[model samples]
Target: LTVSVVVAAKRENITHHQHANVGDLSSAHGFHTTTSTSYYVTFLVESGDRIELCVSGTEYGMLVEGDTGRLTFQGTRYLSFERI
Candidate 1:
């Protein structure tokens, strides 16, 4: 519980960061991506597990194959998300 709270509090405005391929981004042609810093409380994650985006502050249900994701940035974009 404490770990979860810490992680949740750690989030701030997302930084438009790197271009790592969203490994499980879906394989269909009509995939739509959402944005939000909040991840589902139920989803268990590990290193290298593809973290799905939820721009609407919800949870990731599932992902399709072939879908791709990349964080974008411009000169004036947020930098805190600088992916450590």
Candidate 2:
């Protein structure tokens, strides 16, 4: 899937940095994406910085199955972000 993390000093700002696409979910955890599929974005910011999560693509396939190899196409998804 494709995602972006935009940060700016004001709400009117639209500047952003495009990151690479994330790969498939991990086999160990059917609901979680691979650990290596994370993005590390670094930029200058102040105390009142504004960050946004923007998505513009399909996160799953047409016929995704469950861990048991059954036809289960509905589940939960998550995203994680950490400041260094």
Candidate 3:
């Protein structure tokens, strides 16, 4: 997955980073599957900094015969900030 730290309103991308294959298949049933993953970025910033987390993926192809289906992602995602 690709990650970026962007400044709100300005829409300026401060950093462009990527983590390849940063996910796992936790469970699967029929054409449905469950995935879990985590990511973190260590950067210096000020308080009230508006950072956005954007995640996107691309589909290569499918295996089922003559079956065309689209993939949907829906889950709970949260981000916590801390100083170190």
> Tens digits of per-residue lDDT for model 2 on 1-84?
222222221112233443344453443423422332322222122433322332112322121122111111112222432222
Candidate 3 Cα lDDT to native: 0.27
TM-score of each: 0.16, 0.14, 0.17
Residue-wise C-alpha lDDT for candidate 1, range 1-84, written one tens digit per residue = 101111121122443433334553553334345453543211122333333223223212222233233333233231112111
Best model number under lDDT: 1
Clashes of each: 11, 0, 0
Clashes of 2: 0
lDDT for each candidate structure: 0.28, 0.26, 0.27
CA deviation > 4 Å runs, candidate 2? 1-35, 46-84
In the range 1-84, model 3's lDDT, one tens digit per residue, is 112222222122334443333353432322333454333222222443333333222111112222222222222232332211
Report the Cα lDDT for residue 15, model 2.
Answer: 38
User: 58 in model 3: Cα distance from truth in Å?
Assistant: 28
Instruction: After the best TM-score superposition of candidate 2, give how far the Cα of residue 49 lies from its true spot, in angstroms.
Output: 10
Lowest summed lDDT across 10 adjacent residues in model 1 is found at 1-10
